[model samples]
Target chain A: MDREFRNNKPDMFTVELFDATSDLAESLAHSEVIMRFTNSNQVLINDQDAQRLVQEANELHQKLYAKDASRDFMRENFPRYRELQNQIASNPVLQEQSEAQEMAINFLREVNQEISQLLGIDFGSLTRRPDATC
Target chain B: MDNLTLNEPEVASKSRVMEVARRFTETLAETAQYRALEETYQAFRQDGEAQAAYTALQTKQQTLRMVTMLNAVGEEDRLALKQLEDQFYGLKSVQNYIQAQETLISMCQEIGDILSDAVGLNFGLACRVGGCCG
Candidate 1:
């Protein structure tokens, strides 16, 4: 028998049962994740992680410059990439020489903190849930 | 109906993992990199302000160099977003998979309830009649 037939054509009882079960699962999962993310507060990206990320970004920047036109698909996406790159390159938050790295870290910290509040969820709860993480 | 396996202490089964992977692959490919790059490139290529700004960097290089730099920056942004999104994609995929299964489980439970109700009402009658009176 067709799968849809088995599912969609179920008698009224089966339909009601499926509806109740699916609703419970959705609610439970959503609640679990929401609580977890709320509890975990904000995830901290240490200097090391920040450094690795920035280094990777720079490396990617250079490598793309080196690629031949036909070899890479950069042509497809150069415009918005340029804007983001310009933002990184020009932002006072990112441009400070003596405090640039620290500034970046602080900026990210601020952003993450704001995000935490915006999300109104805890990180601890996120981890406790079976597979929920943000 | 789906089983509740997210809370299981062990590793998720391969099928669950695969389901998550498939869900993210499309999001990862489109939103994270290719689409953004294309948009950024258009901004850089079409706007005078963008051109003037980029020309500073462009002047230092030959035509190929300029192309390469734009492409380079584009690639850099794409990769950065990709890495960031990949991490997010991974986390969300697991969460989503678990959530989806939870939904299925709930559905199954509802189905079970409905079956029980029907049996209470008619299963005995059906057995007695046997389609056309066995």
Candidate 2:
């Protein structure tokens, strides 16, 4: 926007950049890894047993950490919490979802690395949200 | 099922993703903000005065790192550091470089948001070098 540093055809450049960004996003979203991740996630979310287990675990977690909960109560419920987590971990659907998500994330990181190498800058770090803690 | 190892299909998909990412980076490099950032950075790098001021500030900071961490910096040392910072920021080239970087970062943030929304994940966060703990 500053005239001193303005490039020719700024508007056109912006449009092209946005279009390219969208294309990249679409390609990533449609990639086999990402699609597999999405499908597994959907399957996990749609499973009644999985949803119930997750909800129960969340409720128990809240109770364990509640202000009024006694230390003894937390100690007693901790094992149950671990059991619920193990159940979730052992579920084939959840396992598949986790594996797929990891693959998708790795694929995205590889793409980001390619872009960063080409641009000579950490694209992910540069684009990170200002308020992001991690 | 080992997510760490990419299968043949995943490898092919990753290549496609990188191709799109390359196009996105090329478009981004042509943007006005990117051009301004590059130009201003080059100017700053070539400005001897600005470079000297930056080096001075960095050296002072390094020298005072322990004292500053311990909250034992004397008035003289603090003032000296402040003066170096002021001098560094007062340069036209430095100011231009900072402005250009901020503008480019803002544009990149918007692009990151678009990617995150389309892919149902935080693109920048996911691509970060380390996970949340880092």
Candidate 3:
């Protein structure tokens, strides 16, 4: 919108740029990685047992750091917590969800690497918040 | 599966994706914030008084590098250095450049957020240089 830039004037570059960005956004939205991540996340969120386990873990974690906390108390409860986590992790649906989530992340990282290569700048880093260490 | 070719079809479309990325970058460069940053940066560079003040500050800082590191610099020298820095920062072009650069960074963060959410990973985090920004 600034009148100062020569490249900002009406031109083929502008049209191409707009079309490219639109196409990219649409493509990204329709990406299988995105769809899989969304579905897997929903499934994870809807798992009642998983939610209950998470809540229990949080409660136990809070109690571990309470004023009356003890290493022995942590040792006693931590194993049960780990057992529950292992059980939840072993669920076929959760396993698929976890794999899908990881797949999606890898896919995105590859995509970002490609973009960074094209721009000769780390597109992902450029877009990161200032306060973010990584 | 071990090599992470989760989807061959998606990988094949990498070129189109890069084209989209290039277009997006072009559009971003054309934005008011980017334009303002460039303009202000040029102005800052061309500003004789600001440049002189900055050069003087840098020279003084270099000269007092050891003393400052050891916290042995006198209060008078420290205050003088601080005053020089204040004068350099007080320039209109310098202030504008800093503000514009921050605005551009914010814009980049927003765009990165969208990409990260779409891909289900922190894209910005992955692209950070040395896992941090200066």
| Number of the predicted model whose lDDT against the real structure is largest | 2
Report how large a share of the reference interface contacts model 2 reproduces.
Answer: 0.70
Query: What is the per-residue lDDT of model 1 for residues B82-116, given as tens digits with 9 covering 90 to 100?
Result: 55444433443334444544443333333333322
Evaluated at residue B82, the lDDT of candidate 3 is 93
Give the top-scoring candidate (TM-score): 2
Docking class of 3: acceptable
List runs of model 1 lying over 4 Å from the truth: A1-134, B1-7, B13-19, B28-37, B58-134
Tens-place lDDT per residue, model 3, B1-134, is 85667443242254556566666766776777767887898899999998998899899999899998998999999999999999988988889889987776766675665565545556677554355321
Native contacts matched by each model = 0.01, 0.70, 0.45
Report lDDT (CA) for all predictions. 0.36, 0.81, 0.68
- Point out where model 3 deviates above 4 Å: A1-22, A62-68, A114-121, A129-134, B1-14, B46-81, B113-134
Docking quality (DockQ) of candidate 3: 0.25
Report how far off residue A40 is in candidate 2 (Å).
Answer: 1.9
Residue B39 CA displacement from its true place in model 2, Å: 0.7
What TM-scores do the predictions have? 0.17, 0.84, 0.64
